[model samples]
Target chain A: MTKSNEYTDSSRATVNRRSFLKGSGAVAAATALHSPAVEAEPQAAANVVSGATTITLNVNGGDHKVTVEPRTTLLEALRSQLELTGAKPVSSDGSSGASTVLVDGKPVMASTTLAMAVTGKNIETVESLGGEDTDAVPRAFVKHDAQQCGFCTPGFVVAVRALLNKNPDATESQIRQGLNGNICRCGTYNNIIKAALDVVKGGV
Target chain B: MKNFEYAAPCSENEVLQLLSDQSGQTELLAGGTDLVGLMKKMIVTPDRVVNIMEVPTLKNIEAVDGGGVAIGATVTLDEILAHPYLEDYPAITDAILGINSMQLQSQGTLGGEILQRPRCWFYRNGQELLDTGQISGGDNRFHAIFGNNGRSKFVQSSRIAPALCVLAAEARVIGPSDSDIQMIPLLDLFRTPRQEGQREHTLLPNQLVTHLVLPPVNGGLNATYEVRQGAGPEFPLASAAVSLELDNQQRVHQARVVLGQVAPTPWSSAAAADALMGQPLDAQAAETAGLAAVEEATPLSHNGYKVQLAQVAVKRAILRAAGLETGGL
Candidate 1:
């Protein structure tokens, strides 16, 4: 079947709907503070019953009330539940660092951090930096072919974003040290570093 | 992973209460770097986990007024490397940076790294070597064919422990009851495996390590040099960390030398330290100290090469610390 025939307008609409729902989740979460006390009561009750403690996570100028298990890793909570799949899970073990996220303005392997442990701090993932239109890292990644299987892309992107945010004018050695936690088993370190440098050079 | 109960207490009193309430079945979760990995591997199956991340008193880095820095148990290795005080203490920073891999550095806490289980293939594999209680296959070859003392034949995981020993750091452990804080010399923390089923560190089930206090460097050049087989998911074959306090004329005043991946604990070379104490840090002095450090080394059938490599590392590290070129020593 032709590519055009395979993707019907209905499938396109379904994709759009999913994106809209995700966007709506973000909006609802944003406006949650101004929500009426009556409406907030049910949400708070839901969170308690869902085995999630109320965590005041400030991310990119927004506060989110996410419910999570006590032992739930910050990476798993961000991806599987919050749909913030920016931090990829390269290895179930925390060694590969496909799950790097910033907590309280410091980068950490989210896979090794329990979600509830970071209850009162700020947590930032790749999505916090790159909106759909203004993301330079993802675009440069495509230009440089920094990703192969695409499984490790989100983590690299998030980690680089955190590094650049901390040090926008990072030297090559600094970039290497900053990104040392992340590993690309496909041997794409050169391209990945180049992409990161591209962003730094462009001052993006 | 089994479902476990978690508690984040705010105060030391509360933490003690939890430990007292759930002594045997509970595991303290600091950075969760090693604990989570062990849980995934099924090496540990705790029914309850007590998270001390929220206890602000336990996560601090403060100066001790006299000299030295107190690093909290939950302080990440990245924090230690970036701390301004560590700049004055090169040996501490060198060891912290030697962990090298960013992922491990970010999540591996100073306390957790020191307390982490040995990286034995048999223990990590879990099911295969249940009978032997070792971490590798009984081929006793490949990863296992090294300077193993037969009982818990595994390499120590932390690169920083040896460095800490060289700096004469002290670990402050909070008791299971949380009423008193005990300061133990870092060297005493590791026990021979024969005493306790091959686990080196002497941490009781309910006790928690609150911080590591690094004494001040009086006036010495300190350095750590490591030699790994390769830089991927493997521990070092031989490594050495040396701290030498120098007098006005560059004569050694006090010396601490520690070695890693050669024994179960951070092996201190008192003989090596004694050799360098009153002498100038020259080629002759370094060679004497290096040779003295490994004189009693009993290598496994396949690991005799480690003695030579460790001696070389000791020589290079001392040379580098002394600001001398390592000229084909």
Candidate 2:
């Protein structure tokens, strides 16, 4: 589709690495404080409902309440219900890993996880990274043209962001192991690695 | 995936009650990595999925009373990989590192990793359990080489099962009632599923695996080595986990060797362990032990190469455990 780097000079863009991390860290702390209050007194049978039930999902620092069938996966709910199509649903098995997302600051295969399982958990998708965070991973991805077909880019960006959040100083081998869950059919692994290293060095 | 009832219980009592009522119809969901894939494949369509991820007690890795470590059932593989205490258990760390993909390790739990369904493509296909026997054995390359004498040929595909077996880990199980708790040796956890109704492990329908306890590794050198088709994620063609207790002169005082992806269970090799006993873990001893590890292997037509691969894996694991050279040897 002739994709090009749209956001140049991302280092001077909206949020630098330090401020971005500080903002997210504040948000994470506030969320942690509010979590215990959200479920102080656990309900008895109210927690064990049958059939298609209404549930609350905390996604992207916001509360998303959706009524879904019990079999609905997080990937299905995000794409079909919430219309968050940034995370691609490549394979139902999740081995392709085009449905990668951050669950409580960890990279989880959303397609393989049930939506009901992540009731109070924080879910961050590629769509959630555009604000004050100004995630450098996506910019680095564009800088290197790490993706060709682009179907796998969102998942890679989210996966790389999660990896860098945990291990900003990840080595080359660690970087390869960290992002091994996501796949690129276009064989852009070397470029992807380069872009991730850029983000790690430039501070994501 | 088929529409089903879902429940996330907060306490152990709620979990046991739901499991007791549902029995065989309920599928306990941990990290949902394997269970969701099985559901998508229509292999297991449970009436209800009990989400046990929130169960407070099952998500810990702590030190037991002894010098051993107790890993809770819900601990993720990524947590285990990043754990500071894992450095002492090279067999475990190396075994988990051989898993290839970070996504599987991150999303997958210790309980889910060990209890994962077989990776046999034929088994995971849309064939019904009863109809699985109708296959007249076409392209049995990925099938079992050690446990193929029975109707089933699927090999267990766990990265940590063999390592846990060699380390003499034990599983603490909690049943429908608190009084029903039982401790089982890790090696006894697997058996050949001869019939459609039989599962790979002996856990009862109402029972839940709580923790895995590994005794203190006292002055033993251990490691896991695997042979795979590629650097990306593929089931190991053959793998070995070896633990050796050396005497003052570096002679093998005791050895525990286990092979994975070669049998219906984590195949423990007394012959290989015996071969290493009283012998220095040199190249000759490693080679002899490797050959002895596969002495009983009856390979399928296409999987005969797995025996040689398994031999190399055993040799490499032995060498790696002993802190010696492995590539040229």
What DockQ does each listed candidate score? 0.12, 0.22
Q: Please report the candidate that would top lDDT against the real structure.
A: 2
DockQ-based CAPRI category assigned to the predicted complex of candidate 1: incorrect
Q: Taking the true A–B contacts (Cα pairs closer than 8 Å), what share appears in each candidate?
A: 0.26, 0.48
lDDT of 1 by residue, B209-235 (tens): 766877777666788887767545446
What lDDT tens digits, residue by residue, belong to model 2 across residues B226-281? 88887777678889999899999989998999999988889888999999999998
- Isolated chain B TM-score per model: 0.89, 0.96
lDDT against true structure, model 2: 0.79
Candidate 1's TM-score on the B chain: 0.89
lDDT of 1 at B32: 85
